[model samples]
Target chain A: MTASIRQMGVITAHLIRKVAFNPAVVWLIAMPLVIIYILGITMHGLFSAEFTPVKPYRIVVALPEEAGFLVERISRAPKHFAVEEARDAQEARQAVFQRQADAAIVAADGDEPLTVIAPPGSIVLEMLAGVVQASLEQEAQQVAAAQPPVENGSREESDTGARSAGAADGALSAMPWEGVGSFEYFSIGLIVMFMAFASHSAMVHCVQDRSTGAYLRIRALGVTRAVYLGAGITSGMLLGAGFSLVMAVITWTLFRVVWGNAAAWALMTIAGAASVASLSFLLTALLPSDPKGVENAGGTVYSLLAFFGGSTVPLTIMPRWFSEIFSWLPNRKMLDGYLKIVKGAGVKEIEQELFGLAAAALIMLGLAWLVVMLLKREEV
Target chain B: MATHAAVQEARGQAAGDPSIVVEGLRKSFGKNVAVDGLSFTVHPGEIFGLLGPNGAGKSTTLSIMAGLIRPDSGDVKIGGHSVIRETQRAQRLMGVVPQGLAVYEELTAAQNLDYFAKLRGIEKKRRRQEIEEILELVGLSGVAHRKVAQYSGGMKRRLNVGIGLLGRPRVLLLDEPTVGIDPQSRRHILDSVRRLAESGMAVVYTTHYMEEVEYLCSRLAIIDRGRVIAHGPIDEVRALAGDAVVLRLPFPRGVLDEAAKVESLQNTLPMPVEVTSGELRIVLPQGSRQAPAVIEELQRHGVPLDGMRLESPNLETVFLSLTGKALRDGKAAEEGAMA
Candidate 1:
């Protein structure tokens, strides 16, 4: 057993050396970083705070007698809320149906104080409703404070009021700009995608070795099949980890994107590496001995996976149903885990995603083993 | 000198166990039988040659002996370990150098040797020394640090052999190790094989080049159509052509056109006369005794000879006699089938 381990170590070292000198590996490692950097610099204005939308949320106010006052109030935060005056409820509803406005508000002289009508399943409508609710609540609080204090208030009531006020303050304080910039988010995606490709290139090395007779030579040296395959996997993982480190350094130093929870990031990195390596192995094992065939097939499959996994485009811009489907992909989970780590998510919060990635890695590795076993039998 | 003596001593210690026993080996690829009921053995200090045309089951047999492939119905044992049942032990006692160059082109010669040494379970402390000795044995010590990609064909072939010699196994299988290289390198490789056998190692050398077998192999097996047609010591196998001597008489075209005249010459020549394109070949049972008479009769008939020569039998002639075709013809047929 020790001898096998030693042999695996030797093969792994040789594979690593081969990768280190390979020009293709160097290009694969540098490509994603260069592309992300260029995109970041050229599209800097798109992510700047000053380039806020002119009118993000359009709302029509139709309150009859109080329409002007409500419109003025809603329009105070013009960058976030765009208010348009309507002649009446009918006009307001017509405007929303025509898609001229995202939503409409109607003041009522009934028990419900206000009525909000918007398109079904619209995120913009949800945010508008939240904003309106918060505004109304603040107004009601001020009106209450202006009145005389009640002298017979119970001590339990006062403590409850104080706790509620503190909780509201905490929520407000936590509501700062916690979103990731487009450059940073896409950079992470590109890094994950490149790592997958780099792992595939490692499998390409395996194919080359086999074609060039190096594999036969080592096998004749008494190296077991398991040791040979184990060495390849180990080398791929090491190469992936190295690429991840370079990506992390470049992003941190250039874009100042900080990762959260070092332990979680490390775990995610390892899981991601295993997933990519095993997937590459499975794909390569399925291909025939022809190197060109393997390259073309692997390239096509990986490109399709990267596209559907949100590496080519952000899931946020994709249709909701499509993004949901993308969410099930391992590369998508890898990107999500890394993004969450960068957004200050703790280990426990991202544990399920990490588990998914780990499970995927294990399953792929198992499949890869079965494929290799079949191939070995055919070889014999 | 010290390294050579050390190798000698190591081989001497391993001499008692240096025997490769192949028993009833049979293998087939799908419907094509590559080897059929083949068996052979090599004792210590012997160079056993496997001479066959292309696709004649030489490589398949070698692969089975090296434990790289499992036979369909038989087994190979090296140093008392079955290749199929005791693979690791059997493999430890054997080394294989494939027909193709198997060294990594991106790595230096030293690095390639070092890597294989480690895989062969050589101790790290002695790896450097062993690598140096192997490089020396293959005459590649001077270019040890150069990348194999930059080396000449001979250099790479030498490195390939060096990698196979790292563990110093009792049995070594070389499959066409000198296929395409300079003559100097071929000579060096042949010399190395001779030295290895002299130092008490059993070597199985496979090649298509007949001269190599005639010069190096003490005993050989000639295989055709996945079966051994002839097997024995070199001279004994050559004697398969029998006592007939071959005489070549190149004549002018149309010199022996008359059937009656040819029959008359045949009756007087003391041998059978076979006429081919512009030449007359005579196979005599005792050429030295009847040579003068045969030449005088041919001259008397005015056969118009352009040139005349007498030859002895060799491996090529023996191969032709056994298979009824030359080795080149067999190779061409194999190529045509493959194409």
Candidate 2:
């Protein structure tokens, strides 16, 4: 076991030298930082405009003339309330449907519960509902103070308060890139992107090793095939992780983009490295004789991955299905993790992305193992 | 020609049990048979040559003996360890210098040797000294720290050989280590290999260049179509061709193939006709007076000829006399198939 580990370590170090000494490594580090800077400086203005504080909420209330007191109280409320009276329930519903208002509130007699009408995922919906709920509760308090309580509500008051809080939490989490600057998003996004491209560079090394017979020579030294493969994967991870570090440091220095939570970033970086490195290892194993597929199509493949994963463009700007598709891509998961890390999310908060990346890496690793086995069948 | 005294010295050194023993090795890739029932043995301190063309299964045989691949049947034993069952144990006893330039171009020559030394489990304190010794031995001590990518072809080839010698294994397997390099580099490599054998290390040198084997190896095995057709002491193998003179003519591929296929020219000559990719070899009995007639017939057939040369009986002629095909015919077929 000691010998095996020594062999793996030596070979891994050997491969690392092969990658780190290549003059191309300089370009690997510089190109991504250049892109991140250009993309960050040029596009920050456009994205910052979207993240600016939203306008006042417009709520249309449908209630009887006797209930003018509730509407009057809501209009004077804080939290940027902009309430408009409706002729009837139809007009109130029409206001929300026509997008003229953020939400609508309908009511009947005093004992009847209020109904909220708002579009799904509307950022103002939760706050507006909270305002209307607070008004009703205040009115009920006044009535309760005047007379004896006849019956309790169907659901517990605790439950209603909890649901209101939970709804606010749900809406906030559902929104992507809140409190995230365009510079930070592009910083992490481009880093994650270039991290994957580093695998291609690593693949070129593997191809050279194979073409030049270095791999065969090492195998002849009583080293196991697994050790050689492990070395390739280990070196690949190092190369990719190194790029992200240098690029991250450059962006932080130049663009003032802070990558938060060292432990979280480390895990994501490792996971991203594993995801891409294992994937590159898989291609090398799969194409024993011909790595042309990877050599020829690697740029296009990574670009597609970046485009679909919201690295090239934000998923929020794309269709909703893009976000759904992002969940399946390891790159997208890495981008997600980086975004969350920049937002000060701890390891626990980004564990989902980590799990996703880990699973993808493992699957690629498993597939690579199977390919190595198949290659072993040739006994060469 | 090997001196009788040198052969006697080699014979004395080979008195003990052989260091490498390959028996009945057979392997096939799908429908193509790479090695078929091949057997050979090399004693310690002997520079044994496995002479063959590019596709004569020399590399595959060496690969199997080195435990890099498994033979379909039979096995190779290195220092008494079975290559098939005890592969790692067998492999540790041998150092392999592959046909290609296997040293890492991105690494310095010293770094390449150091990497292999560490991988071979050499002690850290001893590794640095050993690397320097190897670099000196391969004639690369002056540029030990320079990256191999900047190295000349010969320098790279020497590093390739240097890496194999780091572990000081009992046996060395060199698969065409001097295929394409300058005469200076080839001389250096051959001298290094000869010195390795003289130091009591058993060596198996595989190559199609018969002259290298003649100059370096004491004993040789001539293989064709994955089988050894001739093997013994160099003198005995050379004697197989008798006193026949070999005539070689170089031509374009198209002309060579047409010359090989011309039935009238073949039937009229009454001698074996062999065509390689762009060369032809014909063995003739001295005083037969068939050379002028053969050329005239070829001219009559309008077959283009680049030039012609007369050669003495060596492994090239012996191989043609035995297999009735040029060494490179098999090589070309194999390359075409691979392509």
Candidate 3:
């Protein structure tokens, strides 16, 4: 057993040396970091208030008598809006056309209670319309509250209505807090995606060794099959974990991204590394002893996983069925667990995701072992 | 003092029990048989040559002895360890230098040696010393730190042999180690093999080059159709062709119309005559006594003879005598049979 371990260590060390000197590996490590940096810096403003329009939205009210109430309600809302009273409908239209007002609210003489006119595709105009509608709802609620309860209606009905209103209010207040910047969120995705793809270097090495006949030479030297396969897995794990930790440190130091619960973070990193390494081993073992074919196949498979596993897009925006399928993927679980940690979740909150990652890693490793055994039988 | 002691110990171990015993080894690939009930042995201080054509199962036999493949029946024992039952021990007693260059091209020569040495379980302190010694022995000491990719074909071949010499196994197997290289590198490799045998190690060398077998091997086995057709010392195998001398008489392009019509030449020469495109080959009993009579007889027949040459028996003729075909023609014949 000691001899086996030592042999494995030596093989792993040699593989690491070979990969470190490879020019492709240097570019593989650098490309993702540069892309993340550029994307982070460029899209950082999109998630902040600074990127919003600076000028307050100007509103013109055509009815003098009701203009005061509308202006007060608009001012009380959580948006930037300036309300001005117009002398007539003609004047309000003129103000809107002249760019004095972003939108105009006129009391209509027809069945419709109000008319809102604004420039096409104006976000501020949309916000102003929402404020007007909310004010009308508030007035109707006040009027209903002042009226006596209907004798035909039961207390359950009134209670149900009150609870529904309270639930709506709760939903409005329960929006996710802006704890992490958009760049930081996307950076995690990019980092995990790239780290997973980096396992191709190990795959390429395996294929090259076989094609070059180095594998046969080593085997003839009495290195057992188990030792060789174990060494490959260990090398891949080291690469994945090493690159991830380095990226994490850089992003944290430079971008001030928060990483919560050190223990959870460590667990997630190890699980992610094991998952990718095992997957790469299985992939390389199943492929023919051709370096180019292994590389092309590995790239295609990893890219597909990255796309469907929420590494390239947010899982929340994906359809329900797609997200369900994505949840079973190792990278998805890794990203989910990482996000939870960054959101200050404890180990207990992410225990299921971590377990899923572990299970996936074991399955992949089992498949890799079977493949190695098959290859060993066919080598001679 | 320590290095000298170590060398003496290695030499003693090599000489004490170094022998390869192959018995009834059989291997088949699906419908085709690669090695069919073949066996041989090499004793210490002996360079055993495996001479055969391209598809003669020489490599298959070497691979089985190296423990790279399992035999269908029978077994091989290296220094008293059975290759099937105790593979690790058997492998430790032997080293194999494959036909192709197996050194990692991306690594420096030193690095490649270091890797193999570690795998061989050599002590770290002695590994560096052994690597340097091997580099010097292979004449690669000047470029030990250069990557193998930058090395010439001869340099790479030398390094491949050097890697096998690490840890100094009792028996060394070289499978056509000089297949593609300049003459200088070939000489260097041949000299190295001789030196290893002199140091009391048993060596098994395989090649199709008859001259190499004649020049370096102490004893040899010629294989054909997956069987050992001949085995013994150089002189004994040569004797298999008998004491016949071959004489080639070149005539004008169309002088020799048919071999059967040469009744006069056959009556005079007391041997069979074969008429080819531009020459007539005559086989006779050894000695110059028949030469003057044959020349006089050909002159009497008005046979147009431009020039004549005489040859003695060797491995190539022995192969022809055994298989009724030349060694160089074996590949083409095999391909034709397959077709």
> lDDT for each of the candidates?
0.73, 0.76, 0.73
Candidate 1 local lDDT, B1-339, one digit each (tens): 344345546655443343888888898888999998888888777789998877889988888887778999878889779989998888888888888788889889998888888889889888989898998999888888988999988889888887888888888899888877777888899999999888867899988777889989989988877788888999998888686566677655455565666778777765566554445666655545667778788889877655788768776556655664445443433332332
Once fitted onto the true fold, the runs of candidate 1 whose alpha carbons sit more than 4 angstroms away are: A42-178, A378-380, B1-18, B241-339
What's the C-alpha lDDT at position B329 in model 1?
A: 46
Residue B278 miss distance in model 2 (angstroms): 5.1
Candidate 2 residues A121-195, lDDT tens each? 334554554555555556667776654121123211231121231233334455456557778888888888888
For lDDT, candidate 2 versus 3, the one ahead is 2
For each of the candidates, the C-alpha root-mean-square deviation to the true structure, in angstroms, is 11.2, 7.4, 11.1
Between candidates 1 and 3, name the one with more favorable DockQ: 1
Q: List DockQ for all candidates.
A: 0.43, 0.50, 0.36
The CA lDDT at A169 in model 1 is: 26
Chain B fold agreement for model 3, TM-score:
0.78
User: Native contacts retained by model 2, as a fraction?
Assistant: 0.75
Candidate 2: misplaced stretches above 4 Å?
Answer: A49-173, A291-293, B1-14, B250-270, B276-279, B285-296, B303-310, B329-339
- Interface root mean square deviation for model 3, in Å? 1.9
